[model samples]
Target: MIETPASIVADRKSVYGLRTYISLFSSAGIGCYGFKLEGFQCIASVELLEKRLKIQRYNNKCTLDSGYICGDMTQEETHNAILREYDLWHNAFGIKELDVLIATPPCQGMSVANHKKGNELKRNSLVVESITMVKRLKPRFFIFENVRAFLRSICTDVDGVDKSIESAIDSNLSGDYNILYKVVNFKDYGCPSSRTRTLVIGVRKDQLEVTPYDIFPDKQPEKTLRETIGHL
Candidate 1:
């Protein structure tokens, strides 16, 4: 059972069900929230930073068995290595599909450091690749985390070039994917950071009825930084 705070900040139970295999991408091996799921196990994790991977491996040592894959996700060799380690392949891992995939691609393009350079060729290309992976994996559910600028940037296309992120993703995926895009704040979800992120959730359309949003409503009051920091 989840420990009850004075009030529920986010109803995780509504979002994820019991006993799931989760794949975390480009983050510190599946942030604290993933641990909150009652039976959710992070079977596979990917991180680019060596230091962050070390920290994640150490902290989540007991929870994660195979260890986190440290490298870029876009590289074919890196992706193959991760799949092999996780036994994601048919007959080998005995696992056919994953339950959930959570990715926080680099937000540098949308970050304040980039000053609205979200449309950079490299950044946009990475985002496209991330989406393509989603179509290939076809997990029951997926969560994409990016800076707020992601929602604001206008997609572009060169002559005969399909540069739109959504277009690239759609071309790869079947027509049955249902996606929900929203801008969320960590503060409102009981985190101390004032970070605001654009989240895109994709699920097979037939499964949309089971989506967790109904159980977890938006518009929850923000938990002040002071309230969170005091506990630390």
Candidate 2:
């Protein structure tokens, strides 16, 4: 069953409820903050570095009901591990209903700074793995993020077929997903730094498509660096 925002707020008023989430490159679980504040609880996450996962557990007070997988996301083992968790959820009568899946595959290969080696950097193709996982999981919502350079970068795949990153993503994730993306700067949302990124959101056709502006409504009263850092 698809959950509308009203139902989510109504049902999760007392507890975070069972809206599931899985984050890739979870990075100490910080990315879930906004969603968590809105009452979505993470069920699992994957991060490559053990130190980061340990820090995540520490920050969450070691009380998370979520599972964390620390491993190279490009590897099949990582995929299988996540699948097993989902299967367990289903067997436990949880419906395996993943409300959201957010990922930030490593961006180094797509960064212009890495062009010193030409854009065919091996890690550039790792995004295909994330796309493949989305195909398998069929989450209600998914967002893939990376450096802004990712939007125009071209790189060869494992099959030696060179394609634009956007094309590759479309080809790989073709289906009910309505893909939306924009180059957005966090400063517009009162962030202290002018961090810009390419954020791609994929919603199943049945789900309402949302934009960066829809996500961050308070872009004005325009924050100044002085206001942001005055305490520190």
Candidate 3:
């Protein structure tokens, strides 16, 4: 299960029994974070911009045509369209399972620099679009990534009650997923840059054995820019 994703485009001999992934807010398929890698087969991807979709297609070295959708994920039509895609797969494969959902919604609403003194912008609530998809698709695991400020950003729920973004996710997904999150500096993981962000993961309660702590990668020795990219 720790294997890197073998190309799903290859014969089933390589990717058989692997998890299926659907990416939301996917931009050019490069910032997939980790969902489109080994052990996971990216079955579908959605982006708001058509240009990004083209970039994704052009840069796609991985297998699978990657069913792509261009639309606002927060809309009902988008949800219905994705559901229809899943329905078609189920009818053809005889099993209904979308193993993982990864979403990195726009961070303007939750960025610390955006509002130094005011409440978090309502725009941050777009994460709820992903939460709704989880409720509908019932994926075994979900990945939510955003700026570190997302942990403190607040939003209004259907009841109009003020809630932190974390609370909103918990309120929506805790029923099925045991959510966990950590603020990580990717540089510690050997990335050349010092990009820090909040990574939230949800493992379905039934999959308790794969805890949140287990999902994140261990910190590797730091690599300086010279060692990482000086040659370039």
Each prediction's whole-model lDDT (CA): 0.58, 0.71, 0.75
Off by over 4 Å in 3: 1-11, 61-66, 113-120, 225-232
lDDT of 3 by residue, 87-196 (tens): 75566443458788889888877775665545445677777788788888998889988888877787765456778888888888888888887898889998888888
**What is the number of residue pairs that collide in model 3?**
3
The best candidate by TM-score is 3
Residue 136 C-alpha lDDT in model 1: 61
lDDT of 2 at 18: 62
Residue 64 C-alpha lDDT in model 1: 41
Ranking 1 against 2 by lDDT, winner: 2
What TM-scores do the predictions have?
0.74, 0.80, 0.84
- Residue 46, candidate 3: Cα error in Å is 1.2
Candidate order, lDDT descending: 3, 2, 1
For model 3, the local distance difference test gives 0.75
**Could you tell me the lDDT of residue 52 within candidate 3?**
88
Off by over 4 Å in 1: 1-18, 30-37, 61-65, 88-96, 116-119, 152-162, 215-219
Which residue pairs clash in candidate 1?
none
lDDT of 3 at 120: 41
